[model samples]
Target: MSPEEKPGGPPPPPPQAGRCRGARPQQQQQQPRRGGLLSEIRTAIRSEPFHLRYRLSPGRELGRGKFAVVKKCIQKDTEKEFAAKFMRKRRKGQDCRMEIIHEIAVLELAQCNPWVINLHEVYETATEMILVLEYAAGGEIFDQCVAEREEAFKEKDVKRLMKQILEGVSFLHRNNVVHLDLKPQNILLTSKSPLGDIKIVDFGLSRIMKSSEELREIMGTPEYVAPEILSYDPISTATDMWSIGVLAYVMLTGISPFLGDDKQETFLNISQMNVSYSGEDFDLISESAVDFIKTLLVKKPEDRATAEECLQHPWLEQSDEPISRAWNESAGGESSDVTQQDADSASEKSVDAEKTEEDESIVTEELIVVASYTLGQCRQSEKEKATEQKAISKRFKFEEPLLQEIPGEFIY
Candidate 1:
């Protein structure tokens, strides 16, 4: 079988015209792959082009965030379109060099991940940093669900998305990069359709860390922040898993499970780990779906399922083969953790009926917001809180309202 025929891999390009057909088809030799693709990537990095190679289109803004704007640009000779992300070099009188460099390093490390945004080249102006990225015509997945107009997405679509997300995050973990902020808004699509490939974006809040290191900064959106983050505990890869659980909940229920009317209430919910998959909406979802979500939302970071484990769950597989809750600890627990495809292994362990109860935690329709969550009435004066929140309302500077997912052709 040809290399291109390997299961799940993309097909090879068609033969070019005027190219020698070589000998008879039966005598043609299959091309050998050497040094994998890492060597090729290293070569590309050595000769990456500069800003002068591209012609910026007439100031057509594609998207915008707090301190940057993404524009659509075209190559000078090839006219190939690419996304040029321009981030300011300074913010709040502080030099943004460290943060920008960290982000770039993380992106570079994650370049080999297909589901991760591909960074083509980098450039700099006196006051800005420009990243030439593979353009994802599809907007944020949050907006995609809104365009459906029904609030939530179907389980099948969720399966595809979850697979890509797990694969991408697993890749990050393997590279020691932690995406501190992962939400529906940060997940993008390659096109404006359900079938558009998944593209995780916005690494401004991401960090690269060694396995033994941990970060304690309070980061990420209140609604999706992990319980540990709220408690000011050390951050790890599992911290990102918590946000993945919340993201799954939002995609499945069209509701922000932890979002409250105010910041205090939201933080209270997260701190308490107040999450549930109850209610009528969950009735139609398979039991496996709840298992996948619950395993990632654990209060103990160590207990949360790794990205490798999430890929093994039945919900993401969506296979007709008889699914088993039994796991092969020896085999399943060992992996490079680079991608779902590389991490998966069929378990030979038989289900132990004694452990069945462990799988039946919660799967209901009406997800109840934990009322026992501790934060009481606002301790600070309402006026002071209001003043602090005034600037936050303008935090996400998108070209259009965030949740308005209009799926028409994305006119460049």
Candidate 2:
């Protein structure tokens, strides 16, 4: 059989166009054999103008999703690294294209603001739509805080990041946009120093709200989801505010105020604002910061502080005096006790050096493609697995409004 009909790899290249339709003369018997055809076929595929138009730069896969892959890519023309999302076309009966279109359209509309990850460009081929977006190097605020475990950022650092997040949300709200999902994962850092610079990313679930309309969709990560969202009530900027509070709580204490082993349990805990903070680990957190969290975690969406209001809150105010004086005396300096131990033992110092190297490697990799997670790579079971693995549990007494799921009739 002709190599063109072969089943493996790409089909062999078709014969060149200059052959006669009818059988050629005896001179045609001198035609080339098809054994060398595979190279030609591969060349054609690679040489297609569509493929030649862009070079896929080297970037480790940041994340894998069910329908797409998030890769860190640099635009050859601009030399600026961006997150390139490669989404495969749906098979016979699926309509993922529409979902992609919606995300792109919403992002395009919202890209006017600096807080949103700018959707730089969208390119389509027969099989995929490539979405290029700005890359935030410092990685997800979620991972950063979680990595801190017992010792996340101090109260002032938390306040600084929270204020910036609030400002970003306020900007979106003023533009009549609602980022239905506002968790720590969507918050990113552009800088890594003590003073962090943040930018909001991931608009996969963002929606533009009409001035007169209120949304009633239950979207967003469960822990940070607002009360109204769980109840199916109309959502507004308040929903985002609730999420901000959850983020603040997590960043300061390395523990969520809402505890649940699963989505159902987590939702329940969030509804009641049931929470516990480990003083042993979070001694550095200030009372004002904790109070702000209590106010925002109130089950009633109407009672929750708005982003603008949050910015005006006294706890968020800038002060020259250190809020945590202990931090001033102890934060990140040469400790004689620790140094003495390291110096006294060669093995101990070597181990410390190795750990530092590993940590630095992790940070370097994480900074390059923080936006590589695409929804297509996510599997239902895998998502459930992640939830199970990160399960947190505890309960606390509450004396305020409790969240309840809204009935369908009143949800909108």
Candidate 3:
């Protein structure tokens, strides 16, 4: 059964053909929401928009974060299933509400994008803000890397997924929004299908630039942050391209181009632009992929390719055979053949992870989780609020203030 049918709302108009395109399977007619786990969620969402409560029953908990928990949820209304994310208030001293608002605002800004996660709705109670969202059950690309262990993604699959991601990033850049944080964990799969349709999520660190110039915000994951951003130089859509380069590296090699056992080591390697590629791993990758990554990870942000430019790179333009040979025989290893100036710049990146740590934008944490919500909670709250508003209007009255039209009484 479809969730709309079960929610007992009017049959949902078919999703815009271009937007959904057979994304979800059609199901039988669903009965409306009865008293069940879904019903309980609806009540909890209504009472307090924070602190999500759910009954996963048989399904195990996939993961948990400081602010949200992802559990399997099935829609009783339509018998459709989803991953319900329960988001709670931030721990004491954390401004969770504000963070949720930022994420919602960013998602709303990117709502029409197919490559980005779609937020269904948002409602709030005194304690929590319920956000019902379209679930991406296929999970994160990070999981894909973990599963591969040492072997990276198949090159063809990497290109297919990269094309989709490029489209998504292109859409974001067109809107002047720079996703400051771009990593595997944030890229989600709508389905575990062969094509690997992706949806970009988590906008807690996004920035909307006002012009074509570099921005001066110190933000982004260390492994992917551009050197210019670290120097407080400036950032733009190009900064995101740098991260994409790193992403491409991971997709093709299974290991990050610049990795360290600890943050300091990672920062040191990134600062020096120190990177390596095993002969076997390099053989498995294509020249175009390697070239594309090299072009973006350049020390000079200006020289680094922009997302749009990357789409037109010769690597992306070549056939698989030719591209594969470039990596196996031509492109130089840890020592790139870019230029003397670029080499010099890479050598002098002020490997100062210490200074970076002191920057206010640096948040030394494994993960930062914010608001989450279930569809049931949002629907139930709207119903309850409507009912309360009706009763309040009928019973409440307001006395108007007494008129004081008399001129300032001099001697009245």
Please provide TM-scores, in order, for all candidate models, with all chains considered together: 0.65, 0.65, 0.62
Q: Write model 3 residue lDDT over 316-369, tens digit each, in one string.
A: 666554333222233442212222334445546745563454333222211111
Candidate 1 TM-score to native: 0.65
Clashes of each: 8, 10, 9
lDDT of 1: 0.58
lDDT of 1 by residue, 48-85 (tens): 34556887778657766556777888988799989888
Relative to the true structure, how large is the alpha-carbon lDDT of every model? 0.58, 0.54, 0.53
Rank by TM-score, descending?
1, 2, 3
Best lDDT goes to which candidate?
1
> Of the candidates numbered 2 and 3, which has the greater TM-score value?
2
Q: Write the per-residue lDDT of candidate 2 for residues 1-412, one digit (tens) a residue.
A: 1222122334211222212235232222112212110111101112133334456666467444445666777766667777777766663445445445545554544444455566766777777777777777766665555442223355667777887787667766654556666666667777555545777765555655544555567666666788788788887777777878887876765455675655678788777767665443345556677778877877787898877678778788856235441222356422233433444564454677775664443211111112223111111111122233343122111111122221000000
Instruction: Order the candidates by lDDT, highest first.
Output: 1, 2, 3
Output the TM-score of candidate 3.
0.62
- Write the number of the candidate with greater lDDT, choosing between 2 and 3: 2
For model 1, the stretches where C-alpha displacement exceeds 4 angstroms are 1-52, 56-60, 150-152, 320-412
